[model samples]
Target: MAVAKLLLLILGGVAQLYGQTPPNVRPPTEHLREQRGIERGLPFVKWCCFASGCFSRPPSSSHSRTLPHPHSLTISRTSSHLSSSPKPPRSPSLPPAFTIGILLCVFGGLIRAYCYRALGAHFTFELSIRPKQALVTHGVYGVIRHPSYTGAFGLGVGMILCVFDRRGVIMSLVASAVASGGGSDNDQAVVTATLTCVCVTLLCILYFGFTKRMNNEDAMLEKHFGEEWRAWAKRVPYWLVPGVY
Candidate 1:
């Protein structure tokens, strides 16, 4: 019950985040126009229509001219029929895994926010340092050399967890079989279970793999900060997680 409540809270937070608009950025009319543009640009609805065979090619000007009046009327009726048809049933729900994933994502988001706040003026999306950028060795930086990456890794793990289910497992195996071109589909449930275990193992491997990026960042910092960076590295040897990393 507590877990369920927590999940609902996380969902509410996510919904709020999705609905949030940038403060004082634009007039209401301009914002509405931008929102409309974004909605039109999104491929989700189009993909859904295509998948359900509801999508039809728009009538070209030439094609429309060639079509007789009666045929055009029939086309409109066909479109109406398509629209009136019942939608496919919803997929099976996997609430437990999804809720856990959302929790992890929320935690990760908090970590990212903390890191961003701590970095203040020094943070940049690019590898290049600002002219007056100081080496941030306090707060979140003191603990992790790349807290932002840590947050991103958390998000990745969360996303994987989100889809980690029987269906996901089966799909993964199917994908592997297709790629390899030499696998029987027998005992798929057992194969999928094994694949799920392997996926968890891979997630661990990927988490540790962030060390490669850490090394790259270290190199860049060494080039930029020289002795100061070396000193900071000595003080905070851990790239992420104090003892384990």
Candidate 2:
């Protein structure tokens, strides 16, 4: 009888603990948006949409000859059915710490948006080979050749900033260092996640920091404008940081 009572008490405690778990611990997507604010939500959607399909579709046949507007690019033969593709699974609602983390991410995002607005037509997340595409050397680009990259790196750090108390920052820094340094890992799951995040962060930064994106854009420009791009390239000797590279 004593053993039976103890077992019942143990079960009761387990149930109580489960009940004590906060509903806010895992709220809805709308709730997360509410926390991050509407201004930041749009950019999050834009990046998510871009990652989902916007960047993957091939350009239209005439897209190389002439610059297609953002809307037109979406309706092209290669992209017409992109919306029909199966949607990716949604992430679980943000936890408490994640709410704070998203705010930090928003600050970084705003920094990039400011740079983008300053860049206007010069701002592109992908490599464009259009004739009208000019080498942007004004505003933020004038100060830091790859302000976009610095903003993005800041975003990566921000996403985890408020998520884990004291240990969170330490863990995030370790992860960043390990991933950036290309440290090896024995665990397949850990290795896969680390490498994926690192690769994506690097790619985003390289889009503005490295010459590869510029070179690809130049290839397109050379095909279209030829001498115009040659002259521009001469003026912009380095792809990223002006003095360093």
lDDT for each residue of candidate 1 in 4-47, tens digit (9 for 90 to 100): 43354445345323212111222334212223322333334223
Estimate candidate 1's alpha-carbon lDDT, on a 0 to 1 scale.
0.52
Once fitted onto the true fold, the runs of candidate 1 whose alpha carbons sit more than 4 angstroms away are 1-96, 166-186, 194-205
Alpha-carbon shift of residue 85 in model 1 (angstroms): 41
lDDT of 1 at 60: 29
lDDT of 2 by residue, 1-245 (tens): 22332343233223222222222223334322122222233234334422322111122222212122334444675664666875674433223343443444555455566666675654544433333445665665555555655555444444333322222233344444554565544333474466457656655553444344444445655666677656666765554455665
After superposition, candidate 2 runs with Cα above 4 Å error: 1-111, 121-124, 129-135, 143-146, 157-166, 169-214, 222-225
| Highest-scoring model, lDDT | 1
Tell me the deviation in Å of residue 94 in model 1. Answer: 8.0
